[model samples]
Target chain A: MTNQEDQFYITKILEGDSSYYTHLVNRYKNLVYSIVLRMLKNEDDAHEVAQDVFVKVYTSLASFKGDAKFSTWIYKIAYHKCLDALKKKKRNFDTVSIDATYEIGIDQVENGLGQLETAERKEIINKAILSLKEDYAAILTLYYFEELSLKEITKVVGGTLDNVKIKLYRGRKMLFGILKKQLDPETLAIYERGTK
Target chain B: MKEEQNKEMEALSKKLFKEVELQSPDSNFEFKVMEQISSLPIPGSMAKYKAPFSKWVIPITIITLIGSILLILLFGTGNQYDIMSKLPSFNFEAISSPLQRIPKTVIFAMLALAVLLFAQIPILKVTFKNRWH
Candidate 1:
């Protein structure tokens, strides 16, 4: 929905017709759920945290001054809620170093990706994203999947634009590195020969 | 050369991400959220206002502590005369003589009750904040 449309429902809800909130919730559920799931990496936890995000959004709707898009605002809430859940669970993911990411050539990753079926490619990408550190995974998701610009992402992730840019740059490389690792040499060789 | 490769990588990643479907919550996700929202107090409704207990705690504590210390000084020891002599303008005996008639056991019990009540404020504040949030 457009920001104007969002503001319309927000106005109605603020005027005490709270049923209009269902519209807002329906609009952003998938977007919010996707981000939460990507960060927490657990379906059950994602479900719970996503719901909490909406309930929080509903309760705090009065404070939303329309300074940012509703999507960005909800994303900020989802991001922090996921962090809280991760902190509570004390779960950590192995972060691939930037040097390691750089060592893997992009041409090799692209060549390997060209060999996989679309479904396989999708699975590999999703799994690779889920394996990265939370901040990198979240930044990549926000930038690539949600199509939020670096500035909007900064607002959601709460850092300088340069910091987000660095994360995005490194995150994309890390994702390519992970994807290359997931594609076995045999599969790439077979597909490469088939293409030739 | 590096910039061209980075551009290619960006394009490839974007194309791949477009295929990554959003993970949906359960079918009842919206219903569950709405149910929770319905139970919430409507904005601007006459929801019972709960002032944080901690805000009142400081002043109440200061008053309680001062009152207790004065009571102890006036009755807990033989130093009532010393305190009274210092505040000669005030008639301390009139206040202390009547309070002294109360049994020492009752006085101590009241003081203990006040202490317990103040201690419970923090625990109760935390409980209420947790429940509300």
Candidate 2:
């Protein structure tokens, strides 16, 4: 939905019409879940955090004065909730280790070699993203995954514009190093093709 | 590190990063959230609205307002002419009769009740609908 349509439904929802919020949810669910999933790295945790974020948005709609885009604000809420969940799990400020023990046989990749390649590449990128400090991961996710501009990212991450830029520069470098080390050459070639 | 080389590397990293696929959520995820929200007590109902703090404030405000009105009425009865000279007056012909005076108190009470009811409405709907279900 367009921002204007979203604002209209948000107004309706805030006016004690909770049913209309489902429209807002349906529109943004995939994007919001994607961000939370990246940050949390656990499907169950991501789902819980995303839901909490929306419920928070529903409750706090009265206070949203359109000072920033609704997407930026909602993302900020989701980002913070994911961070909070990580903290609660005692997993904050540390990289999530990918357990080799959880790896299945090649039959698990029976869907296709293409999917297998993509999954292997994703594991590397996910590892890289998780390896970065929370602050850097947050800005990177906001910028790359959510496609938020620097100004909006500053607002979402509660940092200055220069801080966001500095983090983005450093975060990308750190992620690249991790990716090159973790992904095999064929997987990297496949990734390059998919991007182009 | 050379600046141009760093920029090129950053661009390549960004390009490679874009290849990361989205992790699909489990099918029953929305149901999990819905269940959680459904379990929460809805806001602004009688039990919450009638908390001791709000209950105290409502009655005290009404009493204070009524007291102020009585004081004004008593003082006006005693020194109506003098006070009329000293104070900026709203024309009392707009309120022609003593019978008309009673409605002012009723109006104040109604206004107070309206404010309370308005405050209570959100809480009521939030709480009641869930209970009814």
| Candidate 1 residue-pair clash tally | 0
lDDT of 1 by residue, A76-173 (tens): 99999999999899987676655632666666677787778898888888898887878888898888878899999999999899999988878887
Residue-wise C-alpha lDDT for candidate 2, range A1-196, written one tens digit per residue: 4789889987775545556666777767777887787677677777778888878876677678887789888888987887788788987545533332333222212222244556675666677776776667777877776678998998887868998887787666666555545545575456556657
Residues B1-133 of candidate 2: C-alpha lDDT, one tens digit per residue: 3466457656665665587755556666556554555544432233445575465666766776677577557545532223323444656554444534454445446666766666566566657776554
Candidate 1 segments exceeding 4 Å error: A98-101, A191-196, B44-133
Q: Return the top candidate by lDDT.
A: 1
lDDT of 1 by residue, B1-133 (tens): 6678678779888887888887778999999998888766555332223343445656666776687777766655652234455567888886866664666546655875786577566555544543453
Q: Which candidate comes out best when scored by TM-score?
A: 1
CA lDDT of every candidate:
0.79, 0.65
Candidate 2 residue spans exceeding 4 A from truth = A92-119, A185-196, B34-126, B129-133
Native interface contacts retained, candidate 1: 0.67
**Native contact share for candidate 2:** 0.23
Looking at model 2 chain A, report the run of 10 residues with the lowest lDDT sum: A104-113
